[model samples]
Target: MVKVLQQATEVDYGFRPSYRKVWMAKQKAIAQIYGDWEESYAELPRWMLRVQLTMAGTVTVLKTSPIKLGDQVDESTMYFHRLFWTFSPSIEAFRHCKPLVSIDGTHSYGKYGGTLLLAIAQDGNSNILPIAFALVEGENAESWSFFLSNLQSHVTPQVGILVISDRHNGIKAAHEAPENGWLPPRAFRAFCIRHVAANFSLSFKGKDARRMLVNAAYAKTEAEFYYWFDIMRTENPAMCDLANRMEYDKWTQHQNSGRQFGHMTTNISECVNSVLKGTRNLLVTSLVKSTYERLAELFVVRRQMAEAQMGIGAGSLRSTRQTGTEHPASVAYNGSHRRP
Candidate 1:
């Protein structure tokens, strides 16, 4: 912003603005456009309430801390702490998607710095379906617990679901805790293969070793996994020990019971983060509104595609019956179908 202001002024008035002057102007502009940081925080409850009212079945959970004056808590002076929200269509759509969820957190570059945590699911056709979102202070045990607990209760309550994420201690703590329902028999936890391979690179350098580790993680059978595992062990015996320490089912495909649905990474969440990257610099209210709009757009497009496919299938079947053709009506998911 400072550089942009400097260059703009230099071109318009032939005078480069001072860094401090540009910074002050930027703050004023933000205040005028999106309101100040504190005011944005105050607008959160009203914004969420409006969202719920405007969008039926939209779920929003906002956590606030009450300000205390010596001994009494002031009801009028509550501070925003955390928020979790999911749209009605997203909730309904997930039942038809693959039974897997990938979660990840991206740093917010807004007026008040924080973290944006996301939980996204994948459809049968390998499309990313964002399910839940949260704004928290940072990634910690308490924040993760709050996010996961709400996610499990509101968004993904189905049993035997798979969750893929990085092996952050906070996430581990939250999922492994019995009350969160993310433990065994309810939901299985797996590590993101990309993150696991990145960690492996920290211990062993070179692309060859990293590729070998990834091959092991992606192997779908015991024999294939050991084939790459033995190669890594031969190259560096300590690498085998390090990989063993991280556990097998958490990273390896062979041990995951096919629950991963071929999604070995948190790429869905990463994709969502990239889509919202520009909004990260906006005020909290603005950021949330942008996400709602984007997700609504996604849902509308997907719905139209599905409706078109159904129409194509119905037409194909009708044509086959009219012609009395022995050839069956085939429907391929390549966004278009052929006549029988």
Candidate 2:
């Protein structure tokens, strides 16, 4: 029965059922298969490690590390401090996406508490592309530094690359620190507008103020930004002063040094977090597996959708040309065609 359910779930979701659900189904099958047997939750960590190890062996360019001491090589020194993983496919896919990447940390509710740090990018079609994932002890300066250091090495931020995230002190310090800061000289950092809006709402009370703040952030030009900003300041000088204290380049689109590609918030990362909510309570390994499987399915589905769209677009272009509605040269072919 458990096997049947697993098959059904994989067919529908491209992955297996959650461990708790599988365990419950196994409980009913135990009497018939193994005669009153049960599995302990404590064994889940080891089981998950085994699965990850197997995956690492099979998947080329797959990286995985279990928690252990940096100095010693003994059982006493071994501990689960963090877990990190990324695959070649994700890294390669990021190269074709926008130069912006959003980083965020979500708390994991597994028996052994930890934080899941993710680095996500946006593709040409504005789809969320998962770049890297790490399970850390917590969201502190040290943990964030470690995660960013690894990410810096992995992704290697280029000139004009944009990093969008919330105003977490750990993240702020990690990127701004002189010695090991992740921000390259050419790259820029921006704050999520939604987070900025929420903070503003807490300090200043009024729907109009909130609307003006958002409008200011989304302004496409300096004149437009100032236009909305003046309204906020005129309505409430104190609130405007507070908002001004935050860096202009970090919140406003017009002031950003790097190309944001029209993204002003870390909502892309947040969307990925929402999808993993159900797996957050699972063991470390299971959570990782769920992320990996779900991402694989997402990539497959989105790629097919994009190809289908391209096919339709090509067909429509051909039909238009045959009907003499527009000449092929007038359709703008890579700067080759020009208007009369």
Highest-scoring model, TM-score: 1
| Tens-digit lDDT track of model 1 for 180-202 | 88998999999998999898899
| lDDT minimum window of 10 residues, candidate 2 | 57-66
Return the TM-score for candidate 2, rounded to 2 decimals: 0.72
Residue 311, model 2: lDDT of: 73
Clashing pairs in 1: none
Q: Which digits, one per residue and each the tens of the lDDT, describe model 2 over residues 300-338?
A: 898898787777667767777788786655654322334
Number of clashing residue pairs, candidate 2: 0
Q: List, in order, the clash count of every candidate structure.
A: 0, 0
